[model samples]
Target: MARKTKEEAQLTRQQIIDAARAVFHESGVSRSSLDAVARVAGVTRGAVYWHFKDKTELFHAVREEVSSPLLARSHAILDSGDYADPLDAVEAAIVDFFRILEDCPTLRQVLEILILRCEYVDDFVDVKAEVMQPAFEFNERVAAAYRRAAALGTLRPGLEPESAARDTLAFTTGLLHLLLGTRDANGIREQVPAMVSAHLALRRR
Candidate 1:
C-alpha cells in the first residue's frame, strides 16, 4: 500500500509539473496562478502546493524538467574525453542539442517559456541565474574542448581556443533565436547541420 501510494504521488507530481509547463507557456509566469495550474492538471490547488511551495518553485521545477536532460547529455559528451578529436565532440554535442529540441515538444515549450514568455522581475528575479547556468556550463565545456583541440594542433594556427569558443556560442545563440522566434523546426533541421559544420570547419587545421 505504501509503495502504491508513493507511485501515485509521483505521478501526481509529474502531472502538476506538466500542467504548470503548459500554463506557464501559454499565460507567462507572472500572469499564471496556482489555481490555473491545478485546473489544467485536474487536481486540487492543494495538490500543487503539496508538490511545490509556490509559483516560483513550480516554475523552477518546470525549467529543470527540460534543462536537466540537456545538461546531462552535454556533460556526458564534453566531460568524457572519449572522442578522437574534441572538436568532433563539440560538433556532436551541438547537433544532438538541436536534434533533441526538434524532437521534444515539451522541451520546445519550456524553452519558449524561458526565452520569450517569462520576465526576470519580482519573484522571478533570482531565476535568471538558474535559467542561464546551463548556458554558462555549456560555454565552459565547449571552451575546454576547444582548448584541447588547439593543444592537439587540430585548430587553425592563428585561432585562439577561447575566441573560437565564443564565436561558436554566438552562432548558436543566434540560431536558437531564429529557430524559437520563427518556430521553424523543418528549416532548422535542414540547414543547421551544414551551418554548424561550416562554423567548425573554420576552426580546423
Candidate 2:
C-alpha cells in the first residue's frame, strides 16, 4: 500500500536473497520458488518482482553475492605481494579460500543451484566465468612465481615454467574440488596439507 524507500527496497532485496538460500538449502533448487522466498523474507511477491526480473536473474545475483567476497580476498592476496615464494603465497591463499567456503553455508546453497538446477543452464556458465576470472589471475601469479624460481636456480635448469605453472594450477584445482566434495573436516585437514606439500614439491628448490 505504501511506496518503499530506496534503503527499504535494498534491505528487502537482501532479505529475499537470504530467504532464498534457506529455501534452496532445505529443498534444493528445483523445489524452491520465488513465492516461497518472498514468504520466508516476510515481503510481498510484488517486492521480489520489483527487485529481480525473474528467478534466473536472482540466481545470478545469489552467485555474485556469494563469490564477490571470495574474489576480493583473492585479489587482496595478489595485490599485497608479501610472500617470497609464489607457491607459498598461493598455498596460503588456498587455505583461506577453503576455510571461507567451509564456513559459508549459504555457498553450499548457491552451489546446489548451479549444479542441480538443470532447467537454468546459463547460470551454470555464468558461475563458471565468475570462478574462472580468479582462477586465471591466480594462474598468472603462479606462472610468474615459476619463472622467478627458474631464474633463481631453485628449479631444474631449462625447466618449462609455463608448463609447470599449468600443471600446478590443474593440480590445485583438483585438490580444491576434492576438498569441496569432502564432508569430513578431519579428512580435509589431513588431505589439504599433503596436497599443498606435493604441490610445493614441484618447486626445484
Candidate 3:
C-alpha cells in the first residue's frame, strides 16, 4: 500500500511538472500562476503546492526534468576518457545534445522557456543562478577537454583552452537561439552538423 501510494504521488508530481512546462512555455513563467498549472495538470491547486512551494520551485523542477539527463550524458562522454581525441568527445557530446533537442519536444519546450519565455527579474532573480549553474559546469568540462586536446597537440597552436571553450559556448548559444527563434528544427538539423564540424575544424591542428 505504501509503495503504491508513493508511485501515485510521483506520477502526480510529474504531471504537475509536465503541465508547468506547457504553461510556462505558452504563457511565460513570470505571468503564469500555480492555478493555471493545476488546471492544465487536471489537479487541484493543493497538489501543485504539495509538490512545489511556488511557481519558481515548479519552474526549477520543470527545468531539471529536461536538463539533468543531457548534463549527465555530457558528463559521461567528457569524463570517460574513451575517445582517441578529446575534441571528438566534445563534438560527440554536442552532437548528441542537438540530436536529442531535435527529437525531444519536452526538451525543446523547456529550453524555449529558459531561453525565451522566462525573465530574470523580480522573483526569478535568484532562479537565474540555479539555471546558470549547469551551464557553468558544462563550460568547465568543455574547457577541461580543450586543455587535454591542447596537451595532445591536437588543438590549434596558441589557442588557449579557456578561450576556445568560451568560443564554443558562444557558438552553441547562438545556434540554440537561432534554432528556437526560427522554430526550425528541420532546418537546424540540416545546417548544424556542418556548422559544428566547421567550427571544430578551425580549432584542430
> Which predicted model would earn the best TM-score?
3
RMSD (Å) per prediction: 1.4, 3.5, 1.2
Model 1 stretches astray by more than 4 angstroms: 183-185
Task: Count the clashes in each prediction.
Answer: 0, 0, 0
Q: Which of the two, 1 or 2, has more lDDT?
A: 1
Instruction: Compose the digit string of candidate 2's lDDT tens values, residues 1-205.
Output: 2456777877888998888777776776657789999999999999899999887677667777877777778656744569666556666776776666667777655655554542434444444565466577777776777776677677666668788778877886776666555566567656676667777765656
TM-score of each: 0.95, 0.77, 0.96
Task: State the lDDT at 119 in candidate 1.
Answer: 94
lDDT of 3: 0.90
Question: Candidate 2 regions off by >4 Å?
Answer: 1-4, 108-131, 155-159, 183-185
Write down the worst ten-residue block by lDDT for model 2: 117-126
Q: Model 1, 1-205: lDDT tens per residue? A: 9999999999999999999999999998889999999999999999999999999999999999889888999879977768889888988888888888889999989999999999999878988998999988888888999899989999789888888888888888788878998854676678988998898899889
TM-score ranking, best first: 3, 1, 2
Residue-level lDDT tens digits of model 3 in 1-205? 9999999999999999989999999999988999999999999999999989988888889999878988999899987779989998888888878888889998989999999999999988889998988888889999999999999999999999999999999898888888888854676678888888888999999
Clashing pairs in 1: none
Cα lDDT listed for each candidate: 0.90, 0.70, 0.90
- Candidate with better lDDT, 2 vs 3: 3
| Residue 205 local lDDT, model 3 | 96
